[model samples]
Every structure is written in structure tokens, then in C-alpha cells.
Target: MLTRLKDSTPKTLLLGGAALFSVFPLLSMLSAALQPQGSSPAGFSIPTNPQWHNFVDAWDVANITTLMKSSIILVVGVVPVAVLIASMAAYAIAQLRIPFGKVFFLLLLLGLTLPYEIVVVPLYYEMQSLGLLNTRLGLILPLIGLNMPFAVFWMRTHFMSVPAELSESSAIDGAGPWQAFRRIQLPLAIPAIASLAVLMFLSTWNQFLLAIVLIDDPNKRTMAGALQGFVGAHSTDVVLLNAGALLIMAPTILVFLAFQRYFIQAMLAGAVKG
Candidate 1:
């Protein structure tokens, strides 16, 4: 009993500390947001009256409804195309016995090492040349391209874990390659695909820098870009800013919570198999 108690104490402390660390920032933000305007040296104070109405004011000021629509359009456009392209490419890399497949896969892996900062200039110019600059397509194409490397590599790893015998068995039973992949491989890959989709959605939704650079029109701006504008416009309004921040975070938090089970399962599958 003494040995077990001693072992558990340190773990309990560690977990307590981690929980506090994780929640502190959120608590601070909420406290600041609830604080009344012009009440303290820091320009905020603990509200005698907690202004929940500040959220509505922030939504109106930030034009969150329009920004949200733009964000949705970009996310919806990018996620499906990126996943489909990545899955097909990954499947090819994993299953196709093509010459130079390993070399091509290695090149794809190299893409993970290339940061967006390094390629943004070239990408901007490419968009300009293609007459897509400042358009939704401009914002979307770059995100899809940038996300592809990691997506393909992750999906390829998952695909490789699937038993080759299953494919062969399907072939012997008169299934064509496409049918085999669709009927056999796809079902087994749902977890990995779900994981990839959720991750990609989060990344695409929160993207700020690319949206700022590629989109010049305010109306075309995504939620992240719109949030930056909110900060600029309300530098002194702590309540409004925090409210906007919370609203911006809502979709992502909800998405994670909704699909958390699948995310956990997929990550475990990849980790265990890899």
C-alpha cells in the first residue's frame, strides 16, 4: 500500500499541474473579457456586472457572420479536394508496384520539411500568373498544395499497414483494382481518413497568414483574418476582443469534441501500426 501510494502521488501532482497549465490561459482570458471597460490601470476590471452582452457586440463589430461564411467556403472547398488527392496519391504510393515509387514517395516526404514561409513568395507569383490572385481559388489552392505532403505521407503510412493479402484475395475473386480499393481498402481506412479529415479541417480553418497575403478584399477574408481585423479595430476593448476570440474558437472546439473518439482511435491505429 505504501509503495503504490508513493508511486501514484507524483503522477497525481503531474496531472494536477498539467490541468492547471492547460486551463490557466482560458481562465485569464475569460476574467479579462468579463472585466468592465475603463475600470483599471490595465483598461479592464472584474465586472461588477459581467457583460455577457459583449459577445453580441463583438459578433456585430467583427462581422462574424460574413467571416464565418467565407471560412466555411474555404474549409469546405479545401478539405475534400485535399483528402481525395492525398488518398489517391497515398494509395498509389502504398500499393502500386510501379518503378521509382520509393523515390517518388521520398520526394513527397521531403515536402513535409519545406515550410510555407519559404514557398509563399513563389506561390503568390504562381497565383498571379494564373490570374487567381485575391480569389477564393487562390486561397484554397495554396492550402491544398501546402497540406498535401503531410496528408499523403500520413495516409500512405496507414495504407501500407493494410494487409496486401486482402488486395490479392480481392483480385483473385474477380475484383478490379478500383473496386478492390473502394470495397476492401477504403472500409479499413475509415479511422485514418477521419483523423486526416479532422486534422486538415482544423488546419485549414485556422489558417491566417495565407489568407491575409492571398486575399486583399475584406469580404473575402476568413475568420482568422477577420479576427486580426477585430484586434486592430478594438485594441482597447478587452471584453470585445476576448468575446471575438471565443467565437472564433467555437467551431474548432466543437469539431474536436464531436469527432474526438474517431481522432483518438485513428491516432492509436497509426501509432500502433507504424
Candidate 2:
């Protein structure tokens, strides 16, 4: 017991240090954000007179309301469609045994290996040719495609873990492929689907590179992308900048915090099943 405790002590200390390292930047940002709007905060000193209204001023300056709406619209467009397609494709590949399923799965795996930057140039040209440049659909479509590889892989892992006997039983009970998928597999896949949706929502909400490149108008870009304009305009003001960054980060943080337990459960389930 003493030896076990000693081993755990080192691991616990290491994790504690890592946690502090991760949290240090957020603490510093909070410190800076609470300072007087134009003041430069040194290190991580907390403000004696916290300017809580700095966040309000930053919100107005950043035009966060409009950006939030744009991000919501993008998320609405991308998440459902992406999740639906990925779930169906995964089910087919893992359960239905579609022709050339292995080949298709291999293609998706290849997609995961490629960097997003590699496709940006060609995507730009394609969007221009399609007259989709600077449009919300332009960003939405590419994001869905970009999300597909990992999304499919994640759902596939969950589907593959489901016992084949369940599928066979459903088929014997007069259930068609779609019926079995909807009734048996989908119900069982709720945890995975919910986690995937949360992840996709976060990805869509925080999308930066594609949001900026595909949509030239800052108004139509994701919140993170809109930060480019906010930063450019208020680069000199550290307080407002940090406040704005925190505000932009708040939704994803809140969302993950809310769903973290379920997400962890689903991830553990996948790990054990896989």
C-alpha cells in the first residue's frame, strides 16, 4: 500500500502541475480582462478595482450579437447534416456492409491524415468558380466535408462495437435495414451521437480559418473568425482584447462543461468497446 501510494503521489503531482500549466493562461487572461480597459497588465496581477464593464464594452465593440447569430446559423447548417450523413455512412459501412465499404473507409482515413491547409487553395478556387465565395453556404459546405472524416470514424467505432446479433435479431423480426438502424442501433447510439453533436457544435462555433477564407465578410464568419477584425481594431487595448477573447471562448467552454460528464462516458464506452 505504501509503494502504491508513492507511485500515485508522483503521478498526482505531475497531473496537478499539468492542470496548473493549462489554467495559468486563463487566469492571466482573466487578470488582464479585469484591469482598466486601456491599461496593460503585467504578468498575472489581479486588479484591485475590477472593471467588470470591460466585458460589456468589448461585447459592443466586437459586435458579438451579430457574430453569435452568424455562428449559430453556421452550426445549424453544418452539425445536423454532417452528423446525419456520418451516422448513416458509418452504419452502412459497419453494419449494412455496403459494396466497397473498406475502400470508402480507407478513403476517409486518408482524408484524416491530410492537413486542412492542403485543400484550402483548391477549395478557394472551387468556391470562386461555383460563385459560392463570400457566402454562408460556402463556409457551411466545406465545413461539413471537412468534418466528415473524423465524424464518420467516430460513429463507425460506436457502430462496430454494437453486437452483430442485434442486427440479425432485428432482421429476423421483420425489421428492414433502415428500421433496425433507427430502432435498435440509433437508440443505443444516443450517447455517441450526443457527444458527436456537442463536439461538432464546438468545432463549428470555433471555426476560424475556413470561416475567414471562405467568407470575406466578417459579419458572416464564425465568432472566432470575427475576432480577427476585433483584434485588428483593438490591438492596442489589452484589457478589451482579453475580455473579447474570453467572451468568444465562453460558449464552447460552457457547452463542454455542461456535457463533459456525458462526453467522458461516451468516450470511455468507445474505448472499452473498441
Candidate 3:
């Protein structure tokens, strides 16, 4: 028992220190947020009179309600469709033994290495040609495509980890490919799918550059993208800015908190192993 405790002591301390380090920025932001709306707060200093109303003021100033609606629309459009398509493609590649499966997977691996920035210029022209620019679908379509390679890769890893014998047994029992995938494989892949959904939600919700470039209207942009306009108008007010930033971040934080267990389980299970 003593030896075990000694062995774990360094790791425990290291994790604790890392947690504190990670949390410091949030603590500082909260401190600044609680300051009087126009005040420039010194680093990590607590206000004598906390302006708790800063959040409310910031919300109204930023018109966060409309931004939240826009972000929700983007999330709804992107996450489900993206996850479903990626999972199905992954199942086909990993289990169905489709023609040129390895070659297709290699293409997806290449996609994973491609920088998002490299495609932006071409995507802009493509959207322009398709009359998709300055529209919500404009952002929605690109985000789904941008997320595919990683999502397919992740789900493929999970499907590959599943025993081939189980698939064979299901086929022996007269289940077709779709039935086996829907009933057996899909249920088992919930943890990985949930983790991927959370990641997609985060990426879509916080999308900034594409949102700004593709959508001219700020009201149609994600919360993080809308922040650019809010900052432009209220650049001098640090307190309200921090409050607005935190408010924008609240949903993604809440989502991760809710699904963290499943996310951690998928990670521990080597969700990326192939």
C-alpha cells in the first residue's frame, strides 16, 4: 500500500498542477467579468463590488439570443447528418469490405492531414458558384464536409476493434448488412458516436473564420463568429467582453460536462486505433 501510494504521488501532483494551470485563464476571465462594466481589471484581481449584471448587459448588447438560435440551426444541420454519414461510411469501409476500401481509407487519411486553411479559398469560390455564400446552408455544408475525414476515421477505428466473428455470426443468423449494422454494430458504437457528436458540436458552435467569410450577416453566424462583430463594436470594454465570451462558451462547456463520461470511455477504449 505504501509503495502504491508513493508511485501515484508524482502523477497525482502533476495532474493537479495541470488542472490548476488550465483553470487559471477561466478564473481570470471570471474575475474580469465580475468587475464594473467599463473598468479595466488588473490580472486576477477581485472587484470590491462585483458587477453580477455584466452577464445580462453583455447578453443584450451582443444580441446573444439570435446568435444562439443560429448556432443551434448549424449544430442541428451538421452534427446528426455528419455523424450518420461518417458512421455508415466507416462501417462499409471497415466491415463490408467494399471495393478499394483501403485506397479510400488512405484518401481519408490524406484528408486528415490537409490544413483547413488550404481549402478555404477554393471553397469560397465553390460556394459563390453554387449561390451558397451569405447563407446558413453555406456554413452548414462546408462544416459537415470538413468534419467527415476525422469522424469517419474515428468511427472506422471503433468498427475495426469490434470482432469480425460477431459480424459473421449475425450474417449466419440471416441478418443483412443494414440490419447487422443498425441493430448490433450501431448500439455498440454509441460511446464513440457520442464522443464524435460532442466534438462536432464544439467545432460547429465555435466556427469563426468560415462563418465570417461565408456569411455576411452576423445574425446568421455562430456565437464565436458573432463575437467578432461584438468585439468590434465594444472593443474598449474589457469587462463586458469577457462576460460575453464566457456566455458564448457556456453551452459547449455544459455539453462536455454532460457527455464527459462517454467521451472518456471512448478515449480509454482506443477509439482511434485501427
- Give the root-mean-square deviation of each candidate in angstroms: 2.4, 1.8, 1.6
Flag clash pairs in model 3: none
Q: Tens-digit lDDT track for model 1 on 1-274?
A: 9999999999999999998988777666676666665433243345577877777888888999999999899999999999989988888889865688899889888999998889889988999999998899999989998999899988898888888898889989999888988888888888788888999999988988888888889778788876888889988776778878988988998998888888777778867876
Model 1: residues with Cα > 4 Å off, grouped in runs: 1-13, 39-48
TM-score for candidate 3: 0.96
lDDT of 2: 0.92
lDDT string for model 3 (133-161, tens) is 99999889999999999999999989988
| Best TM-score among the predictions, by candidate number | 3
lDDT, residue 186, model 2: 90
Error of 2 at 221 (Å): 0.7
Worst 10 residues of 1 by lDDT: 37-46
> Would you list the clashing residue pairs of candidate 1?
35-45
Stretches > 4 Å off in candidate 3:
271-274
How are the candidates ranked when ordered by TM-score, highest leading? 3, 2, 1
TM-score for all predictions?
Answer: 0.91, 0.94, 0.96
